[model samples]
Target: MEEYGYLWQLALILMSTKFLGLLTKRYKMPQVVGALLAGLLLGPAVLGNLLSGVVIGGHHLENLALHQTDFIEHLSEIGVIVLMFCAGLETDINELKKCGKASFIIAVLGVIAPLIGGGAFTYWFLEEGWIEASPDSSLFIQAVFVGVVLTATSVSITVETLQEMGKLKTASGNAILGAAIIDDILGIIVLTIVTSLGGGKATAGDSAPLWLVLLKIALFFVFVAIFGYIVYKFFKWWRQRDGKGMHRHAIMAFVICLLMSFAAEYFFGVADITGAFFAGVIISMTQEDQFIASKFDVIGYMFLSPIFFASIGLKVDGDAVMSMGWTVAVFAVLLTVIAVVTKIIGCGLGAKVCGYKNYQCIRIGVGMISRGEVALIVANKGIEAGLMSSAVVAPVIIVVIVTTIVTPIVLKPVFMSGNKTASDVPTTSKLVENYEQREKIGKTNR
Candidate 1:
C-alpha cells in the first residue's frame, strides 16, 4: 500500500509536468517556464491549499504526515542534478576552443562588472539601517552575497533562444555560446571561492585552510582529466569490440557520473552540480558521448528536468514579492537593468578588445545576460547557507526570472539584423576533427 501511494505521487508529478511542458512548447516558450507554471498551479501557492482538505480529508497524505508538496520538492532536487548534467553534455568544447580569446575576455568582464555593480548596490541599499535586518551583519558580507548572485550566467536559456531564432549557427550566436560557456566555468569558480569565504572557520574560531581548498580544486581537475582519458579510451576500445551492449556502457557512464558527483560534494566541498558538470565534460570526450547523452536525455527531460523547474515556481512566495510592494518593484527594475547593461558592457568590451565588430560585441553581451538554472541554483544555495536574507533573495529571484523571460524576446531582433556572414561564425566541426586527428597521430607516434 505504501509503495502504491509513492507510485501515485510520481504519476501525478509526471502527468502535470508533461501536460504543461507540451502546452508551453505549443506557445513557443521555453519548457522550463511551462514546468514552473505547472508547479505553481498545482503547488501550495494555488491548488495545494484548495485540494488539501478534500484530498487528505483532515488526515496527512502519508503515515509520516508527508504532504504531496514535500515529495515534489525532493523530486525537484533530482531534476536539477540531471538537468545540470544534460546542460554540461550540450556544451561544445570545440566551439569554446575556437573562440577562446574572445570568450575568455567577455566572460571575465561580464563576471567582474556584475560582481562590482551588485556588490555596490547591495552595500548602498541594505547595509545600513535602511532595512530592518540585524545591525551586526557587516556590509562586506552583504556585498559578497550580492556579488555571488551576479556571478552566474545562465547560458542554457540563451542558447535555446538563439536556436529558436534560427541564429544559433551565426557569428553572434557562436560568440554568445562561447562566452556563455566560459561564463559558467568562471561563475562556478567564483561560487566556490565565495562559499569558502562564507564558511569562515574550519575549526572553532579558525578559518578553513585556503591552500587546502585550492589544492582540492586543482586535484579535482587532475582527476577529471586522467579519469576522463581512461574512460574515453575504454569506451573507444569497447565500441570496437563485438557483442558489446550499449546499455552496459550507458550504465557504466551513469555510475561514473554519480561517483564523481558524490566525490565532489563529500570530498571537495564543491557543489554537486559542478561535479556533475565536470563528469559530463569528461564523458563528452568519449566515443560513446552521443549514445550516453541520448539515454540520459530520456530520463532527464521526461522526469528530472520538469520537477526541477516546477520546484522553483513552487518555492517562490508571490505574497512576499507583493507585500514588499514598491521596494520590490523598484529593485526588480533596477537590478534587471543593471544585470543587462553590465553584461553588455562587460562582454561587449571584451569582444571589441578581441577585434570583434561593435555589433557582434553587443550581441555577445546580450546573449550572456540570460540567467537560468545555474543562477537559481546558486540563489537557492545562498538562501540555504544563510548568506542571503529574504529581501536579498526576493529581488535576485525577480531579476533571474525577468532576465530569463525577456532575453530571448530582446535578442531576436538584434541577432536577425546582424550582417555577419555564415563564414564569420566559428566552425566547431573543424576544431573537433583537428583534435581527433591530433589524438590519432599521437597514438601512432606512441
Candidate 2:
C-alpha cells in the first residue's frame, strides 16, 4: 500500500497547489507561496491532524502520508534539482560577464555578512548557559552551521518577484541573481569545510585535517573548471545541430544536469543541487538558453516544483515548535530578524561597494533576504548528526518559513514605493524594441 500511495499524494499535491496557488496569485503573491501552503494544508502539520482517516475518492490519505512519504520525498528531491537547473538555465551569462566585478563583490559580501551576523545571533542560541547538555565545541559547530545556513539564498521566490516586477533583466536584478548563485557556491564550500572539520556528529572531524579538506575543495574546482569547459563546448556543438528538433536537446539538458548533480555529491562531496545549478549555467551560455529554460519551465514549474514546495510544508512539526519554550521561541524570532537585517545590509553594502545607487543596493539586499530549501537541508544534516538538537530544529524551520514568506510579499513594494522609476526600468516601447532585437539576433545566431 505504501508503495503505491504516491499516486494519491500526487493527486492531493497538485490539487491543493493549483487551488491555493490560484488564491495566492489573486492576492498578488507568487504561486510558490501558495504551493507551500498547499503542502501545509495536506501535510501532517495540518491535514494529518484534521483528516487522518477521512476517505475521499476511495483513497484514504492515511495510506498516503505525504509528510513522511519516502517516495514523495525522493520526488521532491528531484524538484530541487529542477529548480536549480532552471535557475542555471535562465541565468544570463552575458549579463553576469558584464556585471562580473559587481556581482562577485556582492556575492562575497552577502555571504560574509550572513556568516558574521547570523553566526553571532546563532551563538546566542548555542551558549552553554542556555543549553548545557551540548558540548561547547559542538555548540560552536552548530552556530557556524546556522550562519552557513543563513548564507544560502533559495532565490526562486525572489526570481518570481523580480519577474513579476519586470526587474528580472534590470541591472540590480542581474546583480541579485549573480550574487545569489555565487553565495550558493560559496555556502556549499563553507559547508564542506565546516562539516569535514566535524561540525556535525555524523562526520569525523578529527580524522581529517584542514589541509586535506582544502585540497579536496581545490581539486573539485579544478575538475569543475576543466570538465565544465568540455561540457560547454560540446553543448555549443549540439546547439548548432539542434535545428532539426529540440526534443533531443531537452533530453540532453536533463541528462547533463543529472550528471553534474551526481558528480557534485558522488565525487566532490558537495550538494548535487549545486551541480545541477552549474549544469544550467553551462546551458545558459548557449544560443538556445531561453528555449531550454521555457521547456523546463513547463515540466518543472507545472509538475515537479509543486511537489518540492509542498514537501517543505509537510515537514512542519508544530509540536516540536510548540515545545521549544519561550526562550527558544524568542531566539527563533531574533534569528529571523537577524536573517532579514543581515541580508539587506550585507548584500546591500556589497552592491553599494560596486557603485550602485543607494536604492538599487537596498533592492539587492531585500532581494537576497529569503532562505528556503538550502537552509532546511543544512539544518536537517545537523539534526541527523545529533550536533543540533530537535529543540533547535523547530526554531530553524520557523525562521526559514518566515523569511521565505516575507521576501516576496515585501520585495515589490520596497522597489515600487521608491521614486525615479521612468529612468530606471525600461519603458514599454524600449522593452519591446529590445525584445525584438534579441529575437532577431537569436535567429541570426541560429
Candidate 3:
C-alpha cells in the first residue's frame, strides 16, 4: 500500500539529493547545496506542484511524492542531531578550550548584530506597510522576536563543509564550532527574555522568568558534566573488557545521544541538537570514540543527513511565497541581504577584535550565517503569539534558504584564499602534535 508510500518518497529524496550533491561537488561547492536544491525541486515548490491535480486509480499522485511529510521531517531532525553528535565526536576538546574566550566574543557579537539588524528591519518594514501585526501585539515584541530568529546559526551546514574540506580540525574551524555552541546558548537566553515579555504569545502558557531560564541552562550543563563523566567511565570500561570490537558499543553511544537530546528539549527548553552534540563530546573522551563516530557517520550520511538537508528545501511553500507580490519580494531580498551582511560584519568584527586574520574573520562570519529549523521555530512562536503575520513566514523561508545556500558558496573561496599564518595554524597543528605524542607515549608504556 498506500500506507507504505513513504518508501518510494524516501527513494526519491536519497537519489535526488545524492545526484545533485555530486553535481555541486564538481563546481567546488559543498554537496549541501545540491541536497538543498534537490529538495526544492522535488517538493511542492517545483516538481510537486507540477504533479498537482492528477488522479490515478482514485489515488492522488501528489500525495505520493510528499508521502508522510511529518515522518520525513522527524527523520530530518534525527539527521541534524546525528550530524552534530558526529561533530562532537571528531572535535578536539583542547582546541575548543583554547578558543573559548574568542568563541564567546564571536558569539556575543554574532547575536547582537543580527538582533539589532533584524529588529530594525522588521520595525521599518512594518512602518512601510510591508508586514502587519495584530492590534493586541506590541510592535516592539514582534520586532525583537524577528531579530531573535536571525540570531540563530545553523552550523550543521558549516560542519559538513569543513569536514569535506578536511579543515574540521583547523584552528579557524575550531573557533567556528566553539562559537556556534556559545551562539546557541546565548540565543536561547535572548529568546527566553523576548518571549517572556511577549506575554505568552510565543507559548501556550505564561513564560518562565528569566532567572528560571538561566537556571535551566546551567543545570543542563551540570547534568552534562556529571552524566558525561559517568558515561565516559562506563564506555572506557566497556572498551577495555570487549577486546573484540563489539558493535553494541556503538548502539550504546547512540542511546546516550538520544537521551541527551531528549533531556535537552524536555527538561531544559534547550535545542535537542545541543544535547546530541554534548553527548558526542562526552563519548569522545572514551577510547571508542573513533569507532562510534564511524558507525554513526554511516547511519547519518547514508540515510538521515540527505533527508535532513532535503527537508529544509521541502519547507518552501512555492505558491505562498510566489503570491507575495513585488513588495514582499523586495522585503525578502532586502531581508536576505541584511541577514547575510549583519552576520559577517558582526562575527567578523568579533573575530578581528580577537586577533584573527581578515580571511579567518570572514570564514567565521560565513560559517555562522545559515539559519534553519531554529529560525522556523522562532517564527512559529511569533505566529502563535500573534506578533507576526503568517504571511511573513514566506520571506523568512527565503532568508533561510538563501543564507544556507550562500554560506558554503562564500566559505569555500574565503577558506581557499587564505594563506595559513601562525595565528590560524598554530593551535590546530599543535593540538595534532600533542595528540600524536600522547599516543606514542602510551604505546611506549604499554
Number of the top TM-score candidate: 1
CA shift at 222, candidate 1, in angstroms?
A: 2.8
- Model 3: weakest 10-residue lDDT segment is 437-446
Please write out the lDDT profile of model 2 over residues 66-151, one tens digit for every residue: 66578777888888888888766755555455547787889888888888887777777667445322342466777777788788
Across residues 1-446, which tens digit of lDDT does each residue of candidate 1 receive? 76467676566666877888788667655566666667667665456555544535566432332234567667766666666676666565765677667668888998999888877876776654343232323457656767767768876566667655656666666667667777877887787666655652222244458788788777877877888788778877888884468889778877877887788767876666677887787777776666677778778767787777666656655555456667766766787788878878888898899888877787888888877667767766665555555455556656776777778777887776657665445455443344345335433432
Over 4 Å off, model 2: 1-3, 49-65, 128-137, 154-207, 239-242, 351-364, 371-401, 404-446
Ranking, TM-score, top scorer first:
1, 2, 3
TM-score of each: 0.80, 0.78, 0.74
Clashes of each: 1, 0, 1
* Model 1 whole-model lDDT (C-alpha atoms): 0.68
Could you tell which candidate, 1 or 2, scores higher by TM-score?
Answer: 1
Model 2: number of backbone collisions: 0
Relative to the true structure, how large is the alpha-carbon lDDT of every model? 0.68, 0.72, 0.76
* Candidate 3 vs. true structure, TM-score: 0.74
**Model 3: lDDT of residue 124:** 86
What is candidate 3's lDDT per residue for 1-446, written digit by digit as tens? 85776788898999999999899778645566677778778887777788889999998777655532777867877787787787577665665575568888999999999999999998887777665455546677777778888998888678678767877667688778788867765776676556545653434355677788778878988999999989988877876877775588888999999999889777886656668878888988888776677677677767887887777667666666566568778888898999999999999999999988888899889888988656755665555456676557667877887887788888888888888775444344454454445435433432
